[model samples]
Target: MAKRPKVNPNEMSFLDHLEELRWHLIRATLAVVVAGIFAFIAKEFIFDIVLLGPKQPDFITYQILCDVAKSVGLDESFCYTEIPFSIQNRTMSGQFSIHMWTAITAGFIIAFPYILYEFWRFIAPALHENERKASRGFIIIASLLFFIGVLFGYYVISPLSINFLGSYQVSEEVVNEIDLSSYMGLIRASALASGIVFELPIIIFLLTKIGLVTPQILKQYRKFALVGILIVSAIITPPDIASQIVVAIPVLILYEISIFISRMVLKKERKEKIEVKSITKN
Candidate 1:
């Protein structure tokens, strides 16, 4: 691909920046729409084979969990014959709305790289050439982290939550029946939230670059961050020690990774500054 000529932000009018941003947004939207079209067309594959995969008893996660539980001489808590729930549509238009929105969500996920490219394009011109070079793999790294988080949420969090909540009985008086919209919402939220959470290191990198945060500050607040992460874990997963631990472990790892990223960014900034000083002295 031919390199894009960098625009000098100092010479560009405010209106010009807005105009450039508009087209980037337009292209991002187009990419999502095109991906959504495919999601809509392959509704069965997306819905039955992918989205509803966790809801089935035969899911890999359930099988693995069952094996571990049985080996430990505990109840095979996850060995469900079937998820004790039925997902239903309550409204006349609920199914259609669900279809459209689900497709859009899938579209956004599939076309995320393109969207990130547009986002980078919008901001790249404003950054120093060296900064842009340093961030050349931002989109790829971000996408990879996001997809990993999605898989984690799908394979770990979703099944954990679904199995616990699905089988939980309140005196066996209430049968579990979930609305289609509700189940879909849970799946989407878990996936997207985890995806965003996994971008902690990237966020830390940006914040460190802009002088808003540092490795020292992160270390200083380590205890508080631990508490906050626990609370977040409770919110995302079932209110249980095991579930919370499962969700929090990766997030804690990400936080530690963010500290490392911050240290690296700060070190690089200092080196660059020293180089500038040496150049001026010469």
Candidate 2:
């Protein structure tokens, strides 16, 4: 295969930059489409084994929760034999539409690393040699954090939310027959949302580098952020305290990590500026 041409930073005009960006975007989209096609081919496994795995009673999250409750000497209500909800398609074309969309979502998730690579490629020309070296592991670290978030969402948030919402009822007369699209939406939302949330530190790092955010500012608004986190948790999980707490813990941890990242970034930037000043004087 022919190697792709590299962008020449100094020689590129505005039009050339746009052309380069267009190709990168095209390549990224093609990657997603190819992955989506594979996901479409694995419809049964995708829908049952991966997407709907959390709804099963034997899901690892439920097992862990059961153990924790037992250790605490609480009621074994976490040990469910079955999830009370039944998922079905109400619209005639719902299943097909969902399959297509879900495949695309899966494709996007699977190809996220490559997408980031393309983004880095676009931005690399604007960075100094030192900056590029400093960010050498950007793709790997960002991808790892994203996958970790995905796992946390799939194994923790999705299962907890499903179990709690699937079992909740106002009266015995109401049957919990969830629509297939609705069920998939919840799983997708939880997983994608968590994946993005896990990028908090990276986001803060960039913002700090660009002088947009600071550790002190983050500290000052910690209480407001707490409220925002709680509200986000409530929106994503069931209104029950257990479910909310389960969702909030990791997010709070990520927020603290973001603060640390901001501090580190600021320190590095300041040190670099001081060293540059010393060299200029010498």
Candidate 3:
């Protein structure tokens, strides 16, 4: 394979910047497509083991929750032998379409670190040498946080929501025949949403860098952020209090982490300003 030519950002025009960005995007998309093909080939594992895991009674999440509930002398709600719903494909192309999309989603998740690396490469040229060095681990940290969030969603939120929604019914006569698309949609949405939500500290850091966010602002709106986090938890997880609380706890912790990050960023910026001032006065 040939290497990509490096372009000096200082000499690049607006159109040159656009061209550079376009190439970065193309490389990122190609990475996703390649990973997607692999995921597509692993259809059985992807579908039966991963995407459908939350709905299965023998899922690890269910087993763990069952054990926890039993140890606590709580109701055996998580100890069920099976969920009360069946998934079906109502349309002719439903399975095929879902397979393709699920592969793409898996590809994105698997290739997230590469995507972030591409993103960093595109932006790094514009930053000072010190800034680039400071953010050297950006891709790794962001990717790790995202995967952690994805695992939380899959093990904690998805199974709980699947159990609650799949078994829920207004009457004994009302059996749920969930559409295949809907079932997969819930899993995909939960995982991806949580992944993005876990980037809270990164987002706060960038906003602080741009002077749009501060530690005080995050602290002042802590209560409001709590309400928002709860609402987001309710939306992503089952509406039950237990499920919502389980989902909200990590997000609340992330919010606190974001505040600390914002404070650190501001302190760094102030120290830089002071150094610049001292050099100028001398």
Candidate 4:
């Protein structure tokens, strides 16, 4: 839905602005809660099909890896009948807590577009008509990138981490019995962290709009960005070079895309400024 023009914000007091922001936030929260309710109801689907899928050796990614291994005459490390680790709850309330938080996370992910819409509505009053129009479909693009990142994390990063760390053993005496909270934490962090990380282009767009970044600055810091991506990958994935590289590649691609977004923003801003100057001369 298109956001309607808000009343001129300059006429409103500080309290009024706060009140307006509060309502937008409330609506966004409500949307998340509503989506969360659905997630809670569909616990089987979320936990079984979506969340636990990565733990199974026969998962799509694992299957593909196994197939590639056979084709290359390499060891089929991914083709076990089951994963080596088992997830359990240490506390009586652990299961309930995991359920609630997982539902909430799912809700937030599902209702992300609505939340972004509320955010846009809240800020629309402060923007000129042209600026608002130029930012059309911001929510959609951001939502798409986030969903892609979530899928990537689930399909690639989560699986690889699970396969490697879940199967790794320090000695014959040690067993990999992962706690419910720990397992869920890894999945949650992987998915949510990747989603936020994929917002690089959007962040760059906003920075460019505010004149804080340019194509040249991005190019100049490209090497530094690569280092940052590697650091982030190491933090998110297990201590394996393959998983880190897998996670870092998309982030590097996103960084390049961010540069392009910054360039486009600059081009649009300059064209708008030129039009304004031409109008003033006329």
CA lDDT of each prediction against the hidden true structure: 0.90, 0.91, 0.91, 0.89
Kindly report which residue stretches of model 2 are placed more than 4 angstroms away from their true locations once superposed. Answer: 1-7
Instruction: Estimate, for each residue in 1-282, the C-alpha lDDT of model 2 and write its tens digit.
Output: 456687578899999999889988999999999999999999989988998889889888889889999999999887889999899899999999999999999999999999999999999889999989989999999999999998888888888888888888999999999999889998998899999999988889888878899999999999999999999999988888978888889889999999998988888989999999999999
TM-scores, all candidates, are 0.95, 0.95, 0.96, 0.95
Q: After superposition, how far is residue 281 of candidate 2 from its true place, in Å?
A: 1.8
Candidate whose TM-score is highest: 3
Worst 10 residues of 4 by lDDT: 1-10
Displacement of residue 249 (Cα, Å) in model 3 is 0.5
Candidate 3 per-residue C-alpha lDDT over 1-282 given as tens digits, one digit per residue, 9 for 90 to 100: 477677678999999999889988999999999999999999999999898888878999889889999999999875979888999999999999999999999999999999999999888898888788878888988999999989987888889888999988999988899999999999998899989999988989888888999999999999999999998888888788988898999999999999999999888878999999999999
Per-residue lDDT of candidate 1, residues 1-282 (tens digit)? 444465677887888888778888989999999999999999999899988999999999889888988998998664778888888889999999999999999999899899999999889877999999999999999999989988888888888888788778887789888899988988889988888899899899999999999999999999999999999999989878999998999999999999999999999989999999999999
lDDT score at residue 71, model 1, on the 0-100 scale:
90
lDDT comparing candidate 1 with the true structure: 0.90
Error of 3 at 273 (Å): 2.2
Worst 10 residues of 3 by lDDT: 1-10
lDDT-superior candidate, 1 or 4: 1
User: In candidate 1, where is summed lDDT lowest over 10 consecutive residues?
Assistant: 1-10
**RMSD to the native, candidate 1?**
2.6
